[model samples]
Structures are given as structure tokens and as C-alpha cells.
Target: MTDSVFTRIVRREIPAAIVFEDEQVIAFMDAGQVNPGHVLVATKRQVETVMELAEAEAAHLFAVATRVAKVVQATFQPEGMTLLQTNKPAGWQTVPHVHVHVLPRYANDGAELVWPRKDPPLAELQALAARIVL
Candidate 1:
């Protein structure tokens, strides 16, 4: 696969306002800022999605994200925050690289995450749950 925009940023081929970094993960300011302190935390390894991550790697990624969220909260003082991690295109993932958005939110920021409620019957939900192999 061709290098993603994030890959370039990781390689220093592109400039980014990075917030934190370690051997396993990197946290940086998001270019398309939903708020003043919106940040993106991603793995240093170029994996396309969360499922591609090993259990340890995925754990470390969120750990760093939690730390970054604290920093954003202290600095930006936003009313609320959203830690968004999307998957494929159908899941609102525009970027293929696995990352989590540490977004600072305020009242009526205009960002909407709307979806229809399914509200399946209890028996139907139980049947769906029974199909899972996990």
C-alpha cells in the first residue's frame, strides 16, 4: 500500500504539530481541528485499522490517548471531550490509518453524530448476540 498522509507525518516528510511520541505511538494536533485542542493519537507502525493491531499495541495506543486527553482538557478547558476511533468508510473513517480523535467539545459546536435507533426486541437481540463467536 502507498504511504498514508499520517505515514508521511510520522516520517517527517510532512509537518505536524505533534503533542507526544514514543516508540509505539504518536500524538499530534489534528489539522482539521473540530476544536482548538483536537488531537489525533496513532500507532507508529502503519496499520490500516484497529483490528490490524496486536492486543498490546492497541492497549498502548489508548493509554497515550487518555494522557493526551488530560492535557487537552487542562489547556483548552472545553466543556466536554470525545474520543473517536472509526473503522472503514461506512464507519466514518476518512483516513485509512488507525487513529483516535481526542476532540474538545463545547455546547452546540455543530458536530453531529446522528444515527437511527434500531431498538430490536430482547429475543432478537439475544439471537444476534448468540451468533457472535467471541
Candidate 2:
């Protein structure tokens, strides 16, 4: 894959207000801040989606996101918090990188995650669960 904007940030080709970094991950302030403490935690390897990550990579990705959320929570003191991870374009993934948004939310915040409910019957749900059960 060609280098993503995130890859450029990781390589210092672009500037970012990075909050934390280690060998595998980086946490930085999002340019489009929906809230004051909005942040993005992403993998250093530049994988396009979460499904592509190895088990340990995925684990560390979220671990760092959790740590970033804690700091953002204390610093911003928002009414609520949201950890958003998207997949493909259909899943609202604007950036093609494995990252999670740590957003500090307030009352009446416009950020919305709405999905229609099917409310399938128990038998149908049970059948579906059986098909994908690990």
C-alpha cells in the first residue's frame, strides 16, 4: 500500500501533536478535533485495518488507546468519552489505517453513531450466532 497520511506523520513527513509513542504505536491530537481532548491512537506499522493486525499488535493498539483515554479524561474533564474504531469506508473509516479515536464528549455534542435495529427473533439470532461462533 502507498504511504498513508498517518505513515507520513509517523515518519515526520507531516507535523502532529503527538502525545505518546513507543515502538508499536503512537498517540496524537487529531487535527479535526470534535472535542477538546479528541485524539487518535494508531499502529506504527501502517496496516490498513484492525483485521490485518496480529494478536499482539491489536492488543497493544487498544492498550495504548485505553491509556490515552485515561489521560484525556483527566485533562479535559468531559461529560463522557467515546472510543471509536472503524473498518472500511462503509464503516466510516476516513483514514485507511488501524486507529481508534479517543473522543471527549459533552452534552449536546453532535457526534452520533446511529444504526437501525433489526431486533431479530431469538431463533434467527441463535442461528446467526452458530454460524460465526469462535
Candidate 3:
């Protein structure tokens, strides 16, 4: 597979305002600023989506996101925060590589996160749950 833009950034071939990094993950300032400190946390081992992650890699990615959210809260001091992760194209994932977004949010920031409420029938919900549940 071709190396992603993120992989280039990881290799330091391109420059980015990186926030935090470890052997397993790297948290860098997003190219576009949602707030003062919108960060994208990505794994060094590239994959297209969260489903491709091993259980431990997913856990570590979110763990890093959780920690970064706290730091963003402390540094930016926004009223609230958001942790957004997108999947395939339909899910609004612009990049092919997997990453998580941490944005510091304030009231009336003009960013909207909404999904239409789909009230599925009880039988439908039960069937979906049965398929997913271990």
C-alpha cells in the first residue's frame, strides 16, 4: 500500500504541529483548526479504519485520545470537548488512514454534530443486538 500523508508526517518527511507522540501513537495538531487545539491521533501502523485495529491498538488509541482531551481542556480551557472518529467514506472519513479527532468545544462554536433520530422498532433493535452481541 502507498504511504499515507500521515505516514509521511510520521516519517518527518512533512512538517506538522505535533502535540503528543509515543511509540504506538502520534497526536498532531490538525491542519484545519476546529478550535485552538484540534488534534488528530493516529497509529504508526496504518490501517484504513477502526475495524482494522487490533483490540489492543484500538484501546491504546482511545486511551491516548482520552489523555489528550484532558490536556486540551487544561490548555485551551474550552467549555467542553469532543472526541470524533470516522470510518469509511460514507462516515465522513476524508483520509484513508485511521485516526481520531479531539476538538476543544465552546458554546456556539458553529460546529454541529447531529444525526437524525431513527426510532427502530423493538424487534428490529432486538435482531440487531442479537447479531452484534457475543
Candidate 4:
């Protein structure tokens, strides 16, 4: 299996501001931050998307993400928090590696994600869903 940047980071092949790490997961600061204390939590293996992760791996990643989120929340003291994970490129995923983005939100913070609402026909939606079957 080909290794992702996250995998390299986990193996110390690449540098990352690691905040937490375990056998299954690693949490680190995002090199590009959308908000203060933004953290990226990813699995050690080279899973490219959430749909590609095993159930046990998914659970472990979330558990680690929660732990890291707590630290980020405490450090930033934002109004609320947002936990985001993107899948394919169409889902706004820049990296091929699976990762969870922990974003701290503030009351007046201008950070917002806007997507044009498009309600495709039911037939098209069904066809797309069918094609995505693992």
C-alpha cells in the first residue's frame, strides 16, 4: 500500500507538530489553520477516505480526535466547536489521506463554509449513490 503524508508523519518521515499519538491514531496541528488551535487527527495507516477505513480504525480515530479537540477547546476557548471530515475531492477534501478537522468557532468569527444548494433529481442521486458502492 502506498503511504500518505499522514503515514509519513506518523513514521517520522515528515515533520508535523504532533500533539498526541497512539498505536492507531495521531493528532497534530494543521499546517494551514482555518481557526486558532485547529487540529488534524488521522489514522496511522494509509486510508484515503472515511469510507475506506475499517470500523475499528474509524472508532479509534474519532476517540483520538475527541481527546485532541478537548485540548484545542481548552486552549482556544472558542464559542463552540466544529468537527469536520471530508471524503473525496468533491467533498472538499484537499488531501487524499483521511483526517478529521477540529475547528473552534467563535461568535463573530468570519469562518464559514458556503456551498450552493443544488437539489439534483432523485434519479440522478440514486444513480450516483449506486455507483459509490464499495
Q: Which RMSD values do the candidates have, in order?
A: 0.8, 0.7, 1.1, 3.4
Off by over 4 Å in 4: 117-134
TM-score of each: 0.97, 0.98, 0.95, 0.81
Query: Which candidate number has the best TM-score?
Result: 2
Better of 2 and 3 by lDDT: 2
Span of 10 residues, lowest total lDDT, candidate 3: 125-134
Query: Per TM-score, what order, best first?
Result: 2, 1, 3, 4
lDDT of 3 by residue, 1-134 (tens): 89989999999999999988999999999998988989999998889999999999999999999999999999989999999999999999998899999999999999898989999999999999999955
Best by lDDT: 2
- lDDT per residue (tens digit) for residues 1-134 in model 4: 67778888998999999988888888898898878799999887877889898899998899888888898888889889999999989999988899999989887788788989899999999999999866
As for TM-score, the candidate ahead, 2 or 4, is 2
Clashing pairs in 2: none
Ranked candidates, highest lDDT first: 2, 1, 3, 4
TM-score of 3: 0.95
lDDT of 3 at 18: 91
**Root mean square deviation (Cα) for candidate 3:** 1.1
For candidate 4, give the lDDT of residue 131: 98
Better of 2 and 3 by TM-score: 2
Pairs clashing within candidate 1: none
